[model samples]
Target: MELTVDERWDLIDKISKQTITFGRYSHTLKDAIAEITVKPLTGIPIAIAVMYGFWSFFGAFAGFFTDGFFVKIFDEHWLPWLQKVFPGEGGFLYYILVGDPTADNCFEAFGMLTSGLFVAIGVVLPAIIAFYLFLIIMEDSGYLPRLAVLIDTILHKIGLHGFAIVPIVLSLGCNVPAVTATRTLETKKQRFMMATLLAIFIPCGAQLGMMIEIIPGYVGFVMLYLLIGFFVTGFVLNKIIPGRSPEILMDVPPYRMPTVRNIGRKMWMRVKGFLFVAIPFVMLGVLLVNVLYWWGVIDWLADILEPVLSAWFGVPKETVGPLLAAFLRKDLAIAQLSAIEMTTYQLITSVVLINLYFPCVATFAMILKEGKEGGCKSAPIFLLGSLATLVATVFLFGGLLHLIWIILGVA
Candidate 1:
């Protein structure tokens, strides 16, 4: 006969009492490290150090590839070869494909075959590799959960659980998956808030890579500004949005050494995603921007937009093309932004606006797709919420930045 629950437990207890010897468990080195890393005073500094290492590695790896190696391959060898061999040197087809015959660097070339390929293959590819490599290592090592715990209190004030940092971190790589990741949030309010904040404020790895390529010195400033915007907007949304910001129980996993196979697999998948999703967009962005320029649409819009952009944003009219391209690919838009002549302040403002203005098409689609599935809010609420957040963030943050520059006499 099957024993009842109490009887079974009693029998198991008797058996354990008779047969099993209980030993005092010893705390291992991993346990000690975990304890140290999760505590507030220790963990925060460790987290900061880890992030600094991540940043240094990313910069060094991407710079070494883009500057040391690919710059030579693309700018010196590839551009000249294409400029010489491509037919109809000054014709529309030639201009669209090979860009400026006289331009020395791939960036200035602005062609599908030149800048598009170089930016996608050389610049962004390396950045994402470095980013994901380190991220995967951290993830596999089990430090991410401790990080989530450490950052939890700050995130709670913004209506997100500490684990919400996952999506934010992921958004650093790409927003499409980051938007999907919002589903991990327990509450509708949390998910919506996280998604909105990320799409508006977080630049993708490719975009960061391009920023590194174009404005490495100012990337830190831009990221800091965006971080401020993220928190500020999140605070407002938390206070105003009607919903429960509930506490979540975290399941922190044990620390383990990262294996090469797992790291390689995850990194390959991420880089592959970057390649397939990104390269086509880069090519398309170049093609479309060129077409718009060729058709006089850019010039037409520039005339209409110049007054508003110049007066309100302190950016130049030449930014119209990049702004248009930003919707297609923010990284490509920044690459294009770099080609335009502007002061450091204007470039900064323009790049920030480009990042804040809109989500790329893939990310937009993910928002629409992911919004329909979960929780208290319906799709309309989700979509409109994100759009509203984007609108307020872009104008408030964008206009405020311009005002700051003006105050500093930088504009």
Candidate 2:
């Protein structure tokens, strides 16, 4: 016989109140679920707080290695000798040897792909490892799901469900992984919208590390403003672009202490994955940049890129080198910026544009996968969205700096 509605209600209430003990705590599973799932604000804040803590720790840890080890030891001693051996002053071998075709000195090769080994090892490796460490912890903690619940209402207004939080948060670590994670979502519309946004605005770990180092103190404020612009633009796009918000229904895994071994393994796996892809690109990019310098291609390309690069972006013509390398590896882009001379305003604008522009190649593949899974057949929309955001961000940040410079009489 079927139970009456009143009987079901009574049973639920009883279950909710029933007590069970596990380890040092005791609570009914039903009641625990209610407390976590129903209180969106509480759970969300806890999740975000944990995430902030993790990243802050990572930043400090990575900065230690970059400054204490790589910068102090590698850049100070090893690079100088390598430059002497390669000696790129006269012959064709010198061009390949010194890492730069046009330069007699080693420092110039620091900007080219040859001496870029120092850049990759000194800056990118430590930072990427730290970022993945934080990312993996967040994943294991099961906090990301609760974050979705917390932001569900706001996300709904933006034409997305709470689950969209997964991709957006992951994009901070790297848009590639975030795009891949979009498969967890139930709807195609949700996936496409998220993929476009991730590719367009999310600064991956490598780009972020560059910003932390190269962006001057005051202009760091402007970087914050740029993030505001990212969110605002995304919100507006969510409305103008057609899509239905998916309903939120997700598992809130219990909070448990993640095993040390598990966290270490996960973090290492992510770092290794990135290195496997990044190392090849780093070598190829170095070779390409060095060859271009030897062939006069860099100067020619700089001349062509100068109109947009210097005039519109307010960055020096030299910045074109790093900007070209940005597609190959963002860390190199940031490192290249260090080789150029620019005012604080120009530096901020360039950094903002670099962070906002085209995602790395690995990220593109993940985005395409997300798009296909979501049943959004048109890939051009995601590509165009990313490119448009790039152009708009460059103009916006550059214009903001121009106004500031004029106001201060620094222009």
Candidate 3:
């Protein structure tokens, strides 16, 4: 005996009524919070407030560790001992290991053991810790899913739906896994577009951490500018790219107090990866830069690109080396830039360009792999073309930002 659809629903309603009960109250605390966080009017502002708090805390927390502790220990004790032990007043090995040994700070020294370790442990690690802590809290509390829901309409305007937020969030951790996460999207177009945007706009945790340490007061402004660039680039891509963005269909989990053990475990894993992966790359970058400098190749390239680097980007000619290093590791690239002693405007422009230039080697390979597996067999050509376009776009954007700053008398 088949029941009518109305009868089926009526029976299910009766079953639910019998099975479920709430003591007097109609709603729980979680329900009330969800009601506010999923709404259009209040959700976006709350999201912004939360993000601002995250960064604010990140800046302070990292600064406390860096200036209050790491810098003091390294500069006052470790660096001096290392310098004394490896005293080579003007030798080639000395220059490579401890750059400009007499500089006031490790960052300025640009040494393998000094600047390299200082950047990884002193500067970047603290910021990474802060970011992961906040990220874990949000993830376990279920705020991220609601934030995604709240931004669904806005995302549609940018050629992606709320579902794309998963990869976007993941990209903040590292772009390689973010690229791999693109497989979750249904369409090839979305996968390609998201992968492209992630590579161009999102600064991974390590890069952001180092930027916060190096740029000091201007890190917030630089980040805001990059975010604006992300949205504008997305809007333009939506207009140019020929595809329809699918609507989001996601199940939001219930809010709960995050487990301390889980958060610690996750943070440890991420920090461990950063320590092992990022430190080697940073040390390699220092070695590579010193080698290139000794060989005079950096000077030759700087001379060749002086027209573009200096006249166009408003940065020093030596920025060519950092720009090249950005492809291998963005944190190292930013670390390299910190040693250059440029004006605030130049630093901001260089940071923006490095973010928009290209993905690190790992992410680049992941993009190619994902593109091929996702059926875009011409992924290599497409990535190269996208990279070229990004470089041109960033250069223009950087110049415009510098011009605006100058017009406002801030430069």
Best by TM-score: 1
Pitting candidate 1 against candidate 2, the one with the higher lDDT is 1
* Counted clashes in each candidate structure: 0, 2, 0
Q: Which lDDT tens digits does candidate 2 get at residues 137-233? A: 6677665676777778877766777878888877877788788777776665666666766676677777776666666254347546756766676
Query: lDDT scores for all predictions?
Result: 0.91, 0.68, 0.83
Q: Which ten residues in a row have the lowest lDDT in candidate 1?
A: 368-377
Off by over 4 Å in 2: 1-25, 28-52, 87-97, 100-108, 111-114, 216-223, 372-377, 381-401, 404-411
Which rank order by lDDT, best down to worst? 1, 3, 2
Q: Which pairs clash (backbone N, Cα, C closer than 3 Å) in model 2?
A: 86-97, 113-286
Model 3 score (lDDT): 0.83
* Candidate 2 positional error at 58, Å: 2.4
Could you tell me which residue pairs clash in candidate 1?
A: none
Give a tens-digit lDDT track for model 1, residues 20-135: 89789998998999999999988899999999999999999999999999999998899999999999988999989998889999998899999999989989899889899988
Which lDDT tens digits does candidate 3 get at residues 1-411? Answer: 999999999999999999998777678888988888878788778888997898788878988998899999988887888778887867889898988867777877777888889888988888788878988898899988888887787788887888788788878878988889888777766777888888888899888878877777787787778778888888887788776777757898988899999998999899888888877988888888888888999999999999987776778898888888887788878878877868888888888888888788889888778767755666775677567758766776888887876788866
Tell me how far the alpha carbon of residue 259 in candidate 1 is from the true structure, in angstroms, after superposition.
Answer: 1.0
Rank the candidate models, highest TM-score first: 1, 3, 2
Q: Give the TM-score of candidate 2.
A: 0.82
When 2 and 3 are scored with lDDT, the better candidate is 3
